[model samples]
Target chain A: MPDWQELVRQRLSGLALDPSEKEEVHVELAAHLEESYEALLKENVPEQAAVSAALFQVTDWQDLQRRICAAKKRGHIMKKRLHQLWIPGFLTMGLSIVFLVTLQKLGFNARIVSWRDSDIFFYAPWLVSLPFLGALGAYISSRAGGSRGTALLASIFPALALTLTFLLMFPIDMIIEPIIGRQADFKIVAAALLKDGIGWMLFPGVALLAGGLLAHVLLSLRPSSRETAIG
Target chain B: MIGSGIKRGTAELAVLSVLHDGPLHGYELARRIEQQTNGALRFTLAALYPMLYRMEQQRWIRGTWETSANGRRRRCYRLTPAGKKKLTPLQREWAELFHALQRLTKVSHA
Candidate 1:
């Protein structure tokens, strides 16, 4: 007898079927063999002829992949949009609320730093971290629910955070600077960021590294079929 | 056999007709069509599942998970009421198209 299970697996190897899907294909192929055998016997064809005839009827895996890809491509735009608009926006809003509430609880003097010094501390690290955080957020969301959720969260959160932060900066500067009006000695900040330059890129460079790692993690977490095809 | 669009259409129709009988997994569906055609028609997986899924989206068929006699689970497809209704019209159109093709081919041969 033909090893129908093995035959089916071999046929399905090139196709991007997850374990469950592979098992499904196996059962279907085995059932097909039974039907093929019965028909061949009725026709008085030899067993080998029947098996060969049956094997010839199996569908081509490559064609199925192409079709599935085409279908996904057609429908994925809407999925991408939902991701871009909804999930990340929520994350950003949630983060902003937390930041605002925490800052409000802190006394005014606690935040009353020289405008030049505080602004540099507040904006500079953020300038580096926001994109880094955005990349991290994107990476997480990409794999969030097998890629779609990640893409949605990643796109929206960064945009939302950047917009809100920039808008808040003008008002925040006006409020803080009148009292202290101090500026950071740039040389000190530059030295702090550049100390590890040989080992890492300066401020922006470190952020970029975080973003790249985030992308890797995000890309790694996609569903098996897509990952397998890509690999 | 090699990129013939009309032949591909017939193959799809034949596959749909098999599904009309009941839900069969992909392999069984392919085998049934070949047997019915007496080994004349062959379906590739590329062609079969896409058509099946398309028909599914169109509400012409429905699929469900079923455990087979072999103690393995498979996704099987069956014709819906809508599919049955659509099938008649499609079958009629196919017949007309085939007839037209045959007549044209005959004239060319003559």
Candidate 2:
């Protein structure tokens, strides 16, 4: 019988492949031959005959290529779907936290407190925190593969942020100018938020924003890997 | 003569079936296919590696690096669990097609 390796080399010499990939094929094909040889041996074939018989059972390269392509295409589609869902929720919450924390750090004590019918400072940070909730909702919807959903989410987040800010500011007006009974002192509200610890409320909003942006980048870049795979 | 398009797929099924038993390097795999076909089917190395690489991507098979008898390092492949599952349906389909083709030709009354 021909040297098995020589026989293999002669057969495969036609298909040109990258060196590393070629090596991979070589090992796999060898294992295939060994198993077939064993089976032939069991059938009482002579040693030479069994080895040669095992070689006869092999398939061609073109057929294997088609199967691999189909499989890769399927894997690509699955990964794309996953990218669509994961981007939005992660970003919205991240941004929200950052916004809140940053505001707090700036010593902006924008909160409203009434003592038996009296206004206090404007707690702007607390009000701003409310808008981020809507933003989070929009982000989540957007990432879930709905263009309309993402647009709706993107549009509503700003509205929620603004509405919360507006609603909270109402008490600020009450503090500045007494509408009814004794008005709250706006200075006290400002002082309270600026009191070192209260400044940290901005941390959450900033943190949320950072996380949101990170998710967005990851999703956007998801397709880039295809280039390398194709290469 | 088999159509070029169908021939490739048929060859892959045949090759995968052989590998289903175990791993084999490139040259061995090609020779075995030719031997099995009784000289009907010939496998060329030029086409083998690319197909093997593609199969590796599909997760139907996995390749591991090993040294050959000649002390040359090469990567070898074996059927994965996923590949094992795929073989049954593929084999069924192949048999169905083969029988259908034979019936169309009306060669024998076996």
Which candidate achieves the best DockQ against the true structure? 1
Instruction: Identify the leading candidate in terms of lDDT.
Output: 1
Candidate 1 chain A lDDT trough over 10 residues, lowest sum: A108-117
Q: Provide per-model DockQ scores.
A: 0.20, 0.07
List the candidates' TM-scores in order: 0.49, 0.42
The list of candidate 1 runs beyond 4 A from truth reads A58-140, A145-153, A156-231, B1-4, B10-47, B53-60, B69-74, B79-110
CA-lDDT, candidates in order = 0.58, 0.57
Candidate 1 versus truth, CA RMSD in Å, comes to: 11.9
* Tens digits of lDDT, candidate 2, A32-130: 566557667788899988875766554654554444345444555555434433344345434555665788798775565554564444455555564
